[model samples]
Target: MTAQTGSDGPAAPEVSDRIGGRLLAMSLVLVLGTFMASLDSTIVNVGLPVLSVEFGASVTEVQWASTAYLLAVVAAAPTSGWLAERFGARRVWLAAVAVFLVGSLACALAWSTASLAAFRVLQGLGGGLLPPTGQALLARVAGKSRTGRIMSIVGVVPMLAPVLGPLAGGTLLEVADWPWLFLVNLPVGLVAMLLAAWLVPHVPAADRASRFDLRGAMLLSPGLAAVLFGLTDIGSAGRNTPIAVTALVAGAALLAAFLAHALRADRVPLVDPRLFRTPPLGAAVLALFVAAASVFGTMFLLPMYLQSGRGLSAWDAGLMLAPQGAGAVLGSLLVVKPLIDRVAPRTIVVTGFALIIAATVPLTQLAALSDGWLVAALLVRGLGTSMIASPVMTIVYTGVDPEWLPRASSVLSLVNYVGGAIGTAGLAVLLELRLTATGDVAASFSEAFWCVLGLCVLALAGALRLPKTAPSR
Candidate 1:
């Protein structure tokens, strides 16, 4: 294939003809950074209770550690493209790693809940950029023919991280102090940095004269953070609370303002809202949002059911979900390739969403007799998740111009983070409300299932709207 350059930068050096040693080495290095960055999102989950006790704080206070990180991540996502363009991808990537390492170290030494939360925000500053930046790096090299398969490999970390997080955290806590949770990233970070420095390509920076969209950034970052914050509060306090209601409305209004500004602005917006005019990119973005919602909701609820509902230990709860991880990995390895080659990408995604709905049905019933049944359901769920997630990613760039790849990545990442936050918070709120009426765990979880099922159904509808073309391969 002839190489085609984008306005922002040169195309990645071609690797399809020689995807062996050096390519593999480069991929491993990139995946290492992606995996480590993704891992931090959930690794602190099981540690929440322990940290709560250690700091003599309530669950609500300790929750900020996670919340703060999430908010920072959402805020940082839009800037990734600009940063990568202004600096070099290699330099920005290395800087992100160094920042993440420093944040992790600070988190380990945090003496109070507030201190921990502050450091988590710092950590998120780095964590937020990893996915989109890493994807762009891979996308540049993989080119059109190889994007789907390359994404399948790159997509593994985000899907697998949540599943593995609790297990790793629980295991570490068993043998060491809570600080080990953050400390653990040190070696991984060091190794990833070294590999990336040595193996990752040194792409030249784009020569665009346009500066970062500070105006758009002002509108988007705080707007998303406020909306997410409001969504999170819905779980703790009812929707009617003055704080939540005010935040939600203000956030939505701000986002609307940003959208209008982006549509008419002379300068490039943080993300071009006009991109949604493209049917494929729009459908893919919508599908990704809904899919992320379901994934995050399920990840949030399952561990709770296993630990609190089933009276299992944290370690055991994490272990119980291991089958889902296995199934997801298997799906990425086995299901994505053949289907993308033969079937419409939309069909694959719609089928995957259907499987998610099917898997979720049993959870709504919530009165299963055996662990075997639940495990099987989760296995199917994992397959469905991989099918939808990988395909949606491959399709997101369909109508997108090459110059906009970084901005596109930012948009998707922003949607992904927001969708996850809503899904997690929305489901938790539903579960809490259900339990309020009937103290029965099974009944509450059953009700919560309907909420997530609705989300998957919405995703299915979006998938149906996707364009009819297969990926470039």
Candidate 2:
């Protein structure tokens, strides 16, 4: 396996202490960019009901606003590492921010669902770069020892965004119109763009630059896109059709082709297959995928249970969900650092998954009747989720060498998104099937929760492969 290399080289000079100031500035820019990108993912969700009415579309059709953005991000993510390697990080960062700004404007001006989806694609193309580039910048700025703390802070953005999105969207929708949901990104994106230009340090390419693996990128991007598209289509189709069958078959073929192309390429492939050879790295990736799916899939189902099953309003659901986020912050602050210091990552992960299993078991007992106990169970589940996030991420980063940190982090981040996408879709499929069989939406959802719980158990199995002890700093 080609071990990860630290950002810059082993003996690269440290940024001056003045870098402290620059780091603060750069972090703000990154957080702003992330907030805008993540907000759009869930912000449009609340606006969807209103949008359906405004555009004369069904709720099902309005769902495409989120789906298209996700697919677009998946399609564009692989190219981020290459872009940073070719152009300087600053240039690529600036360009992506600009693209996001333009896309946001287009979304505001969109006259129909079709136009809005197209604009979202543009927004996603830019937003996709943020995760990978953000990690790269963080790794370059903060040395390895500090990486854990940096990532711990970075991790809070994704957790908080979903909670913040509805509040922002509701205010915007109430004060102005649904288009303002998209318009809100404009000023935030522009400020991020300017600050990034000023504060993000530029690392010039080393040794005349690596050749861009265009063919590999072409194969891999479309192949993954096809797979995600197929999965989403299955959820929409509700039954197997020739078109769906063809998409699945084609996606598999394309993915196989992508693997072959990456392996055969003379230059470093778009994705370094060598990273998977390390057992810890591979296991970390798998654990991340499953954990993300379990967590996000539950997030999707729980709110629905509260709203559709219990008849709570959006605001009440948000308020009820607050404890989960609170638990996450608490875990990050109290548990993650000490856990990493004292326990083996495998132990921490196993414990975390066990906690998740414990938390989820209570969910199976939920009924159509409102119960304070159900809300309390969800609060515990959120705590378990918080315990899992940072430690698992720390494990993934520790396995990688410093130089490859950016790429490894990027891949790991992408897998989390991919997992969430698949998990949510798969649970939706299962819920629908069970609903048909059982004639109870709540019961169907409960069965789906059990499936998610089973996946968490599987994740614990993967966590077993982590090193018995933390890697030396």
Badly placed stretches (over 4 Å) of model 2 are: 1-25, 162-168, 237-241, 337-343, 368-371, 398-402, 471-473
Winning model by lDDT: 1
Q: Which predicted model would earn the best TM-score?
A: 1
Name the 10 consecutive residues with the lowest summed lDDT in model 1: 3-12
Query: How much lDDT does each candidate structure score?
Result: 0.81, 0.72
- Per-residue lDDT, model 2, residue 87, is 69
Each model's RMSD to truth, in Å? 2.8, 4.2
User: lDDT tens digits, residues 145-212, model 1?
Assistant: 66677677666567778788888999999999999999998999899888876667666567783688
Model 1 scores a TM of 0.94
Q: Which portions of model 1 miss their true places by more than 4 Å?
A: 1-12, 15-18, 237-240
- Candidate 2 yields a Cα-based lDDT of 0.72
- Taking all chains together, each candidate's TM-score versus the true structure is 0.94, 0.89
